[model samples]
Target: MSDHLVKVSDLQIGFKNEEGELIPAVRGLSFTLGREKLGIVGESGSGKSLTGRALLGVLPPNAVVSASHLSFENTDLLTAPSAELRKLRGLKMGMILQDPKYSLNPIMKVGNQIIEAIQVSNKISKAKAKKAVFDILEAVKIRDVKRVYKQYPHEVSGGMAQRIMIAMMLVRKPDLLIADEPTSALDVTVQESVLDILDNLVDERNMGLIFISHDLNLVSRFCDRVLVMYSGQVVEELVASKLHDAKHPYTRGLINCMPTLNGSLEPLPVLKRDPSWLGAAQIGSGK
Candidate 1:
């Protein structure tokens, strides 16, 4: 038994590339996430997003996944029956994905969609469910819940839609949340507000949070720990407060490469990756 809300070990996920060869998207990743928020940072193609999706069993059909140990709330994720996974996903784990355009129903009103998300997890009347939905919206700092709820996905601004997504995902008060670039589509001001909202909700619920992004500076401020991923592998892990002291050359390269407020954008730092990191971990029995 562990205190960590989620644990993963030697996890692997790969898919057939256009060349018809298995290309690993995530390799031998191991980490433990607890009530405090943790950030996974890396450049594009670093497999940060894929790693988070793997935790929730949301990987695509092309993905071939395996793990020695994957558990949430002490239950082995790799072995949990579909029935059990379904129940857990409904009430105990929430995910806010990158694109609400594809995630939300095109024809449904925003309010109905949020209420439906809640009703899917628990038995509640429409009126009670609407109240719960509004409370969540308020928690995320979206005022005029009534107006926004009645509006369609197309009617709301990108930032408003994002807050609604956050609120909807939180309807069940899940113990774990995996936020994949939650604020990428918003303006700078809205991005900061969303970050603050996440900070508050996670603190209030004492939930384990996995925030994935390519932005190292934001992660430094918002998370308790940070994992630096490179070429489908986690090359470094350190306390967020001490992220500047990350040990790996890859981590150093990434930080040195990031753009600064005053620095010109012409020269972006790039890390040189190795090929051997693509190999899969040798699997064992009953993983």
Candidate 2:
């Protein structure tokens, strides 16, 4: 087996405007993932979520996706049949979307939803699936598993809902997990707890994690490597710990723009945009 779990090269995603012109959203993005957490950090609309969605074959119907090479393990995602893609989703690859309110089914009990996910990925009986669901709920630090099992999406707090989402995705024990701002809605303590669960999964299961967020400090502490994206392109890729040593101006600007508690009282530095970055050499070449 190859060392990489996912391979993407020259991936481009766009949508046709009413005028019938292609407006690119993700341009020539290339990267590879192994059994490690890779963080993609950028502002909103920088193509972080789009890249994750594209990998899962979950992009909108109007999306135009083209790539030189896009593969998951040995399967070519770009040409894979819908059935094949469906089978891979939630079984071999799972995504934890940003908002649980929109992601979860409002009418179904949370436990049933997770049980369905487990059974859909595996041909397990409801009894066994329920056991697995409860186990995963506990794994994600949900204190009252039995109570949460019968509750609807709206019943749980934001933190608990996030954990339930994690449980739903992890019950199948996928090889790859894409977490888009998974902890954005949680408190700091809950966020740390969630991160710990992800850390354990990566270590125990050798799962490849794609953590997408705008929290640079959190990413630096939690991920092994970081991809700094700007305007739908990766401007810099470096070790998470060395983010302060970034060479790209855009990356430096992002770091500088972060508010500091004890630093200068003056206004934060504004990021100056450069058109040349769009055509620059791809930093995330996965070399």
Candidate 3:
């Protein structure tokens, strides 16, 4: 066991292409996490989602995964049993998917879903689970828990539904919360509210957070550390507050492309990636 709650080393994911050749999604990726926010920022095709799925042990069947070391606390998640991973996902490690509409069951009562998630993880009584769910809703700044609990998924607003998802995940008080584009589906204001809820939850719970998104600007503001990926490889790693001080060409391009205070877009900077930075040679560790 170490102070790090999650440690991924030399992790790799590949799948057979049409030509029957293996295509790597995430290659030789590595990192460490604890009680802090870690942001994974890259474009759509940069394998960011696959990286999060890998940690959850929920990769698609076509994918092949191998890692030198993938440990959570003292347990090696890469080889842990399905039952063990289930327990972790339930109580100790929770993940927030990109969309609550897809992740949550449409037919089930929203309240029941949250209660079921918490009850299964904690194996608590009905009364206890109900109380935990209500408290979690309040934590996320969702008012009128009684009404929210009675409503179905389709019955609630998108913002409230997202809050329910957050409440469901947080009820267990997980040590690590992996959010994969948690706000991508919401409107601008709802998105901010969701991010605010996440910020408050992470701070109050003292839990580790891994926020995966394409918006470098958002990640820079939300996290303490940033891992900048380009075409499935980490091009640079920097403290979030110092992202503007990044030295890597790819990282710099990302920063320059962000809309500025002046809001001038006469000629936005385009990323000029060095071909050498793409090959396996430079896919080396950011550590």
Candidate with top lDDT is 2
Candidate 2: tens digits of C-alpha lDDT, residues 157-275 = 98899899988998889999999999999999999999999999999999999999999989999999999888789989989998888899888888899888898988879999888
What would the per-residue lDDT of candidate 3 be over residues 1-287, giving only the tens digit for each residue? 58888888888899999999999888888888888899999888888889888888888999999999998888899888999998787778888887888888899998899988877766788998888888888877778889988888998887778778877887777888999888877777777877887887779888889999888778888899988887777878889988889888778887788778787858888888788878734443333
Higher TM-score: candidate 2 or 3? 2
In candidate 1, stretches whose alpha carbon ends up further than 4 angstroms from where it belongs are: 17-20, 264-287
Candidate number achieving the greatest TM-score relative to the actual structure: 2
Which runs of model 3 end up more than 4 angstroms from their true locations?
Answer: 187-193, 280-287
Clashes of each: 0, 0, 0
Residue pair clashes in candidate 3: none
Q: What residue pairs are clashing in model 1?
A: none
lDDT of each residue in 151-243, candidate 1, tens digit only: 999998878888889888888788999999998887888788888878887899888899998888789888998888887777767789898
The lDDT values for all models are 0.84, 0.92, 0.83
Q: What are the runs in model 2 whose C-alpha is more than 4 Å off?
A: none
lDDT, residue 264, candidate 3: 85
TM-score, per-candidate, Cα-based: 0.90, 0.97, 0.91
Candidate 2: global Cα-lDDT? 0.92
Best-first order by lDDT: 2, 1, 3
